[model samples]
Target: MVSKLKMVLIFISIPVISLFAQDKPELHVGGALRFNYNLSSWKEGQKTRGGDFGYDLFRINAKAKYKGVKLNAEYRLYSQGFGGGMLKQGWVGYDFTPENNLQIGLTQVPFGITQYNSHNWFFSINYYLGLEDDHDMGLKYTHNSENWLYAFAFFKNAEELNFGNNSDVSNSRYSYDVSSSGDGLYRNKEINQLNLKVVRKFSNGGANHMLGVSAQYGGIYNLDTENTGDHLALAGHYELDFGKLNVKAQVSKYNYNTKNPAGQSNDMIAMTAYGAPYLVASEGTTYTLGVAYSVPVEWGPISNLQFYDDFGFMDKKLNDFHDSYMNVTGVLITAGNVYTYVDAAQGKDQPWLGPVWGGALSEGTANADWEMRFNINIGYYF
Candidate 1:
């Protein structure tokens, strides 16, 4: 059934391509294929180091524009099967002015660093916390100026799709698990999120700086229990860029409050059994620091090279739980349209940091205090 649906979508694209070709509509077609190789090690009496090869995913992105109106979409086929296939992002927007626009449909929530600086395929720990690359069904308005930017949005649902449910017995395999705003705390809820930033550009000095603030307020509902939960977050971030080096950092504090005390067991925001999710402290503060340096020299088959280090720390509000942190160091090499990432990472109680090798907090693993892993990802875009 899923294969047939995929075929139908593919056939439908043919005519769309023809329409663009005939009308000369602004259109583009491109995508990327990625692969991963993993090796891992565990604590005593636990699984030893092992290796595996897997397909990360295949994506097709298309965009079309006519005057001030634009349409964009991305379709994906995941090796692990994302609800048969997934629509990563699909949206339409109209530009009232070059600096202002209104967008509707599924799009990324405007919050935090739009993209994290990580060499490995997996994003930073913020991703697992619904703070990065998180998309939702909503309406959004954005404004940009020479020295300022702002965004406001309302989402009908936290997330539009997922692979698991509350009764699934185990959430270990779901892409988002409990941290998902839609299914876990804010299930069947409404979310309003906003972001604002101020920028200072130094044209002659070859540098730029930005300071931003973000906030979110939402509610959650459960049909069976008639229970309601609330989600709230406030964050501030800073960014600096020099010709060859860049720095990105953020500090955020949030709360997942529930009307019924019973919900407290799952009150923890973005709780993943292993990885960074394990580090969440119900009502705590989270901080991220990332730095990258681009090398000037380029050699054969490698047009660009960069080295980066990213770190995250979570301080729980409760005194009994331990603070959590993770550090990743890696190099990114790009040759033409092909890119490769090689990285090593270590974390204390941060399972999502080493998702491929599995994390210490992952189910069925001996609870190790610390974990480490090495990874390589190769991808091509055209």
Candidate 2:
């Protein structure tokens, strides 16, 4: 099933490519190297267990554009380089009006209030939004008018899971009967997302401030039979630019329902309820806040330095009566969730500081727990 999906995407890209061949080509290439140090254990008694020399995450991204079409791709290299891989975002878009555009292909699903705000890179602020944790390969349409912006997308449930070349496959068929032995998670899984966003700009401190609201509906197909589940999410973000300094905040709320896949497929009748098929769902809220200052610095091979920080926090209400932190916003906000808690604090700000032009001083946060992280980054842009 995975192999077939790849073929289909490849076939679709051909036409999208031809539509731009007659226009002037546009290409943009950039990447980031992030060397992170986990100061302490994210969980009280748990310690981070991956990365070489405490080196946490690194990413490389490139894009090419022609006329109204763009092709983008990214590679995320993580600790151990084991669960890191690449993804392609191919799309063609046309202007419907001066401010509205229609696009079709793999694109960013704008849902969570924090998901669309690109300035959360330098602080421990969590006041925006959070929802589905992955991207999609499907069709997307966007509209950006004067005071309002809207976006919607239809996506195939599959996202690259950093397993090397196999990052693009979605159909993970578990060989088993509905009542017997199988990888219950992927056997009959289907996923989809519908996202909407609205933004209103205002003024504060003699700077531009924008307030954004987002809503999303997502789920895997046959969630009841396949035991996947469904979710509803809402989020909001506010950005206030104050001359040389800027501040931003965002908030998010979520409600979810999920069914735990049972023992294999065909052998369920005699199963015990203790470990039987069931659902572990949750309702949660998250918030983020950030502050930044852009300072001019004339130094060796450097342009300017931006110092920033962000904080985020999330609280989860569980349905399965489990005490685990998997559903806890604090844990999931990290870079790799509980699996690697390091991500609990990270964002675009750190990379901006280290990008070769902006001198050391730029850093951001992902998790809004009491523990905060700061980076001394040096950056340069051509």
- Name the regions of candidate 1 deviating beyond 4 angstroms: 1-24, 43-50, 81-84, 117-120, 162-204, 260-266, 269-281, 354-368
Top candidate on lDDT is: 1
lDDT comparing candidate 2 with the true structure: 0.45
Model 2: residues with Cα > 4 Å off, grouped in runs: 1-22, 41-60, 79-82, 88-90, 114-134, 160-190, 222-224, 262-281, 318-382
lDDT of 1 by residue, 311-351 (tens): 88767676555566678889888898998888787776665
**What is the C-alpha local distance difference test score of each model?**
0.63, 0.45
Which 10-residue window in model 1 sums to the lowest lDDT? Answer: 356-365
- For candidate 2, the clash count comes to 54
Q: Write the per-residue lDDT of candidate 2 for residues 1-382, one digit (tens) a residue.
A: 9999999999999988887664878788776565444332233332344322345445566777666666666655554332333343445666656677766655666764434333333223221112422345567677776666677777665442324421222222111001111233322232576777778867655888778888877773333354556667788878777787777676777665545355422211110011122112245566656566766655543445455555554454533221111111121111211111222343322212212111111112333223323322222211
Q: After TM-score superposition, what is the CA distance of residue 309 in candidate 1 from its true location, in Å?
A: 0.1
